[model samples]
Target: MEIQNDSPVNPKQVTSAQERGNPADVAQSGDFNNSNSKKKKAPDTEGGTAKGTILSIKLAPATDLWTTLKNGSVKLRMEETCCGGVSPLTVTQMFQKTVDLCGDHVAIGFKQEKQWKTLTFAQYYAECRKAAKSFLKLGLERFHGVGILGFNSPEWLIANVGAIMAGGLAVGIYATNSPEACKYVALHCEANILVVENANQLKKILEVQNQLPHLKAIIQYKFALEVRQPNIYMWKAFMKIGEKIPESKLDEIIDSQVANQCCTLIYTSGTTGVPKAVMLSQDNLTWTANTAGKMVDIKPAAREKVVSFLPMSHIAAQMMDIWIPMKFGAATYFAEPDALKGSLVNTLREVRPTAFLGVPRVWEKIEEKMKETSAGSSALKRKIAIWAKDIGLKAGYNNMYGNTHVPCGFALANSLVFKKVRVLLGLDHCTKYFTGAAPITKDTLEFFLSLRIPIFELYGMSESTGPHTVSQKDFFRMTSCGKTMDGCKTKIDKPDELGSGEICFWGRNIFMGYLNMGEQTREAIDKAGWLHSGDLGKFDEDDFLYITGRIKELIITAGGENIAPVPIEDSVKSKLPIISNAMLIGDKRKFLSMLLTLKCYMDDETGAPLDALAPTSVVFCHKNECPATFVSEVLRKHDPAFYKAIQDGIDAVNSKATSNAQKIQKWVILEKDFSIIGGELGPTMKLRRGVVLKMYKDIIESFYVD
Candidate 1:
């Protein structure tokens, strides 16, 4: 009732302010505790000693008390009409509900020794509790961070939920993050315990362990320890460390937790600047999970399945792979670590996930692969594919346009081509296909539409806790991000003639704030509590939201014309199928120019873009009589024929431009494509405009030289 820390730890020492002081001094303070005037009983649990009994725990009501952790309080709208009737349950309580309802359901599956190993909901919950106790034993301070660095695995989920359960922030670090980047997040979050996946991640922490005085322990959840370090524990050893810690102690921390308290920290990808620690509360996760899951048609008690491969550090992946599944009692299968490199499709085929989410690049890759495969077909096969694709596109458009009647020959097309293709891609069971975290091109959407696979587009930022607007089969349109979820409101602030303006969000799912950054928080969430998203958007008459551009990415020409780069870039790529990426380079310049990269093959193992052109690009070159194999060949030769072909494509794109200001005046084909490994794209495949500008500064200036 009187929730106070009985452990030998001080709550005052764990202030959310970036800890730069000595931990020893902070450790010598008073007891870690928080309580209101009124007392409450301990959480009620429902589970007998009998095996297979459904287990559930119900926590006491959240007291009118706030922790002293800096930027740790929730700012959720408590209105019953907001946030889909905003559930007043902590993440633990939410997971417990799933356990009670679907305890015997397969909760997690992982590939090992070429077979799938499964875990039930009850087993998953037990593992999380064990992990929570381990984190506590490892000295995870209250409100402090437990930085999790790894590929998406069952252990990763356990570590994340376990940290929150143990009253600490679960901070997910991108696997691609450099050691310095990892250090920045770890130090910024004041991580007391680092849960790393393997030696590679451990090495990153070890490089800066000395600088992190507050980091008390490092637990490697995978691979054997290569070094005998003092505070470094193996996964098995770490789990056993908390055996002496009583269940009552861990339960007390869980029972004291409120729905509106900071429990998760998602660091921004830092595309433009140092990644800000976006503070997400318990309600942010629980509410968004429940609301968005329902919006996407993930029915409760349904045997929904998803393959987890995208970086869990990102909110999109976190929600799809972790929280949403927990909310609906869905099963999650962990794709191999090399999923992005090429193994994802295999995993998709094996799991046959009911729902699949991919970044724009991921979808584009799939489209390219399909095209490449189609190009290799014999005359007869190619003819049938073309016939089926035509019908598929018609049917897809019919559905999008609300024409309930199926297009003629649609059933035949589905049986002959669409069904076969879906089976090959292991997407036959997929009810929802999603693309987000960046703008997906109309070209990619229609390409999939031609295959009877309409990839739904999701729109949101880390601040919205994952989804604000979601496109589903029921409410979908080409290039439209769809409408907001129930109870979540969107407003267009300072609209222009066409109603395009900075989009703002208001709902319970809105994050608490950026950790330790009051000014930034104020800038993001304004006086009316609306989170002012920097992206520009407008809603249609039907209320479908279409993202126009990002305010920051808008190029102000020297003549004072504001140009959005995305539309121009997408148009140019559509015109030139060989062009993989295009960046409009006319900000503050007299005329618009572009930096283009040829569609090229990428190293299957490393995900590094290769110099050789992709099959589609090769086909383009052959058809155009340009005849180029590698990007280097075209760049080195300055192949007049290829350049002229590209120029012709640009001219075609320019003809559709609304104004000369939006037209591409000149352009250059880069030797390589933009990639995460090349540092031009973030983990979610969102282009890092600032990084690209700096990397190609001289090239950009070349187009403008007098």
Candidate 2:
């Protein structure tokens, strides 16, 4: 693969569907030269030789966007014409192929009235078309956004595909986003229609509707509307409104779309600052979905099953739930809205999915639950379980380190404990288990490995269209993200003596620049066309990528030591079983200090952290003979036992530190745990360091007081 700087073809000249011929004919045309730009090597089209044809792409119209981009538009440049084995099909063509191949196969499944209801590929396509027509009838303008604020449901999927089908940008707003955040995204894309999940989401839209001049209508997909107003329609009514729209009109718009034009806008989590809208083109979605699906070995025609419960606003969930399933003809089951609050395991058992991807936090929660359950088991059962886990760990380490020999009693352990544990967790049928979005601690990874479950790690960002590097079963490593998928290239921008540097990506999956943020886009994709990932990583001898730390998260102490906080924080949490979160402080200070939050109970309905201690925390307290049952109780009475136990854990962590600069000199426990509601975590549960610094400014400042 090769990328270079060059002048672009005129957007006005390439806007028409007739001028921009289908990319499928690239092998035949052999027009590899892109206008007057520098000639670069193009990827081989699927089933073709190592040569590709030129694809003229028209940039998206600048509507309600900020940009001083080249030619006053976001740069929709393709460094390579096609990627390895990628067909470069548009979203419409790709979905059409799947429908043609598996028209009668189930594509989506949802629970209704205690029974699983499914939609076939043909039926799903029809629903998307119906929704597209409705969007057209509601006066959706070309390139304008259609914001969908909801959980992962059939309606959400339909609206997502429908907007793109009708030549509009599909913008997903995080379900947990505040009304103000929602307004920022909706207005940024100049949304013409907002499809919300229920009355609660509708109320939020309604609260800000008066301020949105571009919003023409709002559709509520679930529950009865408590307030009625003009231009507000229910799901069934919204579907009917587009009946008068001609099918030909929608078809014309769909046909006009090219693989390089923007179709979706994924907003960042704003952990650093204001969220940037990531412009993903048709090629980005289709190529990434197909390539990544194959990397994980997704079976076709409903052979593969997945539970969709993660936030769709994030690229990971959207790609896994909607895009990948569509590409491979896999069946997707929508988990309930409260799936994360302890109901996901029940759904997993019923569906018996073949593939599952959970963030680090979700996996941690499951690990905690399993440990709590094990602690409550009968003495004999606990003993047997421990024995099995010991055998499991030995076998797991052997396999991970490339030893073919299975440990003694492995078969017996699997049957007696591992199999039962998998069945109880509804992961018995799961062959591919994945964890991503945030760095998972080695402790959590090893715990799952002890159960004969190896959770692979995937590494990528929204700009890379997800799954830049994926750890497959055969290409597994303990803490490293596996090598890049076929056709993608990875590079360490500038290496230190230890070979750590910014991880850069080059592939068809690279997005079409950040929407309306040309300066930021230029910063992200350098002159060489490599998309610079701000993450710090280094490749091992076998080329596996190990994420060391994030460039922005590195803390430079006053003593001139550059310390990575994640590893140290993970170490602290591993030593202290009761600690929920540990943040390393002392950037530009004498030594490190820590702010911690204890494991506490949370309100399942609202996802609010409660004052009471969680079951796992209580178990820790019982084992240590500390009688506190609530976080407030510990704070109200600084019990020496609890403090001593925490101090011992910190001391253990510090003893393992490389130097004095890295050791935690002082520490304080926060009143509450970090959470999305508390403005400390992102939608995907990634820690918002910027938000945390501001929210606890006084506490952090006091740590530096001499």
Candidate 3:
């Protein structure tokens, strides 16, 4: 695969080191090209290819790539396209091929009231074909968009597949999103039909039905609820109408799909305002699944049992729940959206899944629960736990992506200490555990590793479909997300002293562009074809990508220091139990401070009351005392390592910030957690910075006063 840099720019017009007044003359200083002149040949290993250890990989300075354009603009080659030998497959064809190859295999499983309902690969394909016929009957063929608004269920996947099968684009709206937000996505995507889960979702659609002029029909999955509207259609009735359609017609519809055709419109959970509809084509999804699979070592039979609980609307869930399993012919178990915790545990035990995907929040909950149960244990047990954790970390690092070379003492520790921890969490059978969506704390990651669960961290955006980089077992780095996946190039543009810069990527896996917003799309993807990820990241000498934060999310203090709040917040949250979400305020202010919301678990009868839980204040807390006190004491007794990490992070944040933006001078932890339903968080659980600032304007103002 080759990156085509065909942008018209004269070489003579390009800036030189002398013109920039740089004395180093870095690019022409030495015989850098001769560094790899003596390439040694190696004997072929498995699959007729040389297998050897990767010594090192590093990023050259930006000064090396920067050039002045004819238009007086500075241009640099951010990333080279890394396309592998895989061809793009349409969403419809992907499912059809899977069904053809594994007809009797279970394709999807979900709860329907009491018993779990399942669909075989062939049955799933047949239903999708019939649903496609129904969509065609509704005049939704060719370039049309279909919206799916519901929680995780068989119908949601059916609607998604059906839309694509009919040569239309699938657009997913978060079930928790407000009516206005839903309307925004529907209108933005120009969706003509919407498949809703039940009456509640239908009501949200109805509330803004008039606002969406293009929405012609609303199909509800459940038949029990009554929706007295001209546009409403029951899912069963809709499918029954297309039952008479011949299978040949479905084949024709499937064949009509092109590789570059739009498959889905995934709207990102924008932290600033309304979300943008990212236009992901068949090529994008196919390449993403293929590349991401290689990075995480997603093998065919090895990755069979996968327990999926994240929202299907999001890219992370979409990759694991829909794409990856289908590509590898793996069986996936869907967890009930309402009872995620119950379903997760039950599914883990019942399926004994080999692979699982989780966000940082879910893993943190598991860590918290584990520590809670083991707190104040015997000294022998404590020592055993420590010994087990050390061993597990070694094993975790070695076997992260696929490498497995456990140390002798660590192997013994794993058998003695970590084995029970894995059993307790139902992770004894899990071969691969992945964490994404948000930055995970190293301490939190290490805690899971100690439990014998290899938690591999990954990084990506909605535009990339799923994780672009994932930590390998042998080459794992807690601080970095991982190396770039096979067939994808990643680089930081205009890096600072810490090597942090706007992360840019180039590959077939990148989305086509934002739907309908041509101007914004052009701005996001430059003339050189690289996608500006808008995230600030850096690559280490080992090629691991360390994500700092969103470039737009940087907090520039009055002292002129630019702070990336994501890393700081992640460090703090990993240490503090009561805190759930935090937003670092004080941009252009004297000192840095934070507005935090308490974890919802603290309010439950099972856990002790939080000290900051004030029910009435603008910045409410559950109680009046410091919520960190109990958490600190608990950690001090059970895990001194974790306790010190938290203390160190707090001290660092205080010392690093200017006087005005220093460690939250007057902090108030909210009683309630920020959520999409509450208008505090986006659908993807990202804090809405503007909304938060407005909500706590007075409290923020108090910091400025005496």
Candidate 4:
């Protein structure tokens, strides 16, 4: 299966990679409320008068693959049935019902001043109401998108739900977004009020505030020492303003809300152009929460728990960390933004969460850690680990279709190896572990599965309200992205000779449209109301979806052979642990070539290198950015042995190629990987192929010329 991204992970500057979607890694915040600003007409979306111009960067345009169908097959659709009969529950309504069902239940926990504070479902609902009143007092009106800028915090959730309660649309700005990006989103959405995470985030908006005429007020949740500006308010002060308003008005406002109205605007990770705000209604989120919650079995009786480590701004995080838990009143623990780089694994161990939602990198890191641990063990234990893992791999493959009826020796293998590994990874109780936002290698999935961890790969987009298809436990497929989620409709738009086509969806979960952008909206959602996902995929006879890369990204070689590069790149990285990023370049070329980068696992807590490949881990120190110095550091560790190992890995992957056209015939190791700030990766950690091609033109030419 093929997978890719829009620019999200900003590799160097922000921990969260642009176009990688949201990794929720490193964070750097500063506001831009520029004092002097020109006024300009706001975009078509509802709001105050947005002022100033925005520098919009768009990825290469996408075309519908329906035009490429040879057979002109009717779009085949599938929808699963689940979520016992019930009406839609808006997020606000869900909050109310959850409070009623279990007012005393611990709804959420967040660390503050070195202590974790717990809030009941009732307290959370009340807090949201108080925040809603505060937003109303600030003159925020219906559909006036309110911006919440920060890392994942209790305050972020409060502001988001509060804005919706106050009859405004909440726009979540990625914590890694620049002042310019923050300004563009704030203005484009015409945010009347923006709740900043802390002083740093506030400072980012403040530096560019003059340019946003529509912005009426700024609220800082974590910063309390400073005096408030005329339009700025602190957390305590802001809540107090809400107290002045009678409680009856808040109830009335909540009761008056409808599900059809747009509640949130999730902006697409803009790799090439301006991030289009995908308008999702109350129904979209509610239905998604219900269906997804049911499919994943997140219920009160299930004893569910989650580590909210992903970006709250992302739909995946919103669904898993927020909506799903709200259904059963399960608890969510926020991973402190500052501690995420160092404390995530430790936190997971302590939490021992029942659900672990991660991107591919998180799982890969876990796998790498397990391997390191095994490698350091005694010879006999290492042999046992290897034997058990091999046994599990065979059993895992058999269990891909259904539960395994393994030999009695399997239990011994689990006792000797698998169970202990699961405990060390802090997933002993995890039943709903899944990887999204990026494509996880089949090898990674199989390894975890063999370890007795059921790791399902899901498929969906923000346009489809997070996930539309997920690998199921009852009817699993190793490579397929499960089946169409219950209550969602999925179809393949057109078929090639092999039945590959663009994946499309039509259901309550599909987004309403892109806010005020009719043409783009029409392009995305056709007359039949199908949400056309530019991602290409196919459905097996049993109806599981298999993604096959972006239509725009498909490389047609000089020999006129179409090759999907994701699988080949994934194979290379899977076999070579040292390689961090593998970008294949063969568009219109005679043969496939690649650029590789090494991983840098820094011990963030102690300022030491953690990755074995890092010379700074225990060797010499070199922090300068000179290419020669970087190259030396990379080549220093990648000696003849490393070259042979890399070559061996390449040779193995090339052997799997159906034909020579699809194989990576040549490759060059690079000192650095594509970073978001470098304009080489999307927020989702997807390589900006177009940008990468241009930046490394000389290196690419050298590949063929040499």
TM-score of each prediction: 0.91, 0.90, 0.80, 0.83
Residue pairs clashing in model 2 are none
Worst 10 residues of 4 by lDDT: 24-33
Q: Rate residue 58 of model 4 by lDDT.
A: 13
lDDT string for model 1 (585-649, tens) is: 88889999999998888898778999999989988877776777888877777667777889999
Error (Å) of candidate 2 at residue 583 is 0.8
Q: What is the C-alpha lDDT of each candidate?
A: 0.83, 0.82, 0.66, 0.71
Candidate 3 TM-score versus the reference: 0.80
Ranking by TM-score: 1, 2, 4, 3
List the RMSD of every prediction in angstroms.
Answer: 8.6, 6.9, 10.2, 13.1
Tens digit of lDDT per residue, candidate 3, span 683-706?
555577878888888888887776
Off by over 4 Å in 4: 1-86, 224-228, 338-340, 603-631, 634-641, 674-681, 704-706
Model 2 scores a TM of: 0.90
lDDT string for model 2 (1-706, tens) is: 2222122221111111234443223212322212223343444433223466553332244332123321233223332322443334679887997887788888999998889999999999999999999999999998899999989999999999999999899999999888998899988899999999999899889888988999999999998988888999999999998988889988899877766568899999877668899888787898789878877777674378899999999999999999999988888999998888789999999999989999999999999999888888899999998899999988888888788777788899999999999999899999899989999999999899999999899999999898899986777899998878766667776778898888877666787777778788889977556678899998887778899999889999998899999999999999998999999997888889999999988789877799999888877776776788999988888878778888999999999998988899999999999987788988888899989989999999998888
Q: Considering summed lDDT, which 10 consecutive residues are worst modelled in model 2?
A: 8-17
Q: What is the TM-score of candidate 4? A: 0.83
Tens digit of per-residue lDDT, candidate 4, span 326-416: 8678889898664345578777777788888887766766776676566567999888877887788777777775656774578899998
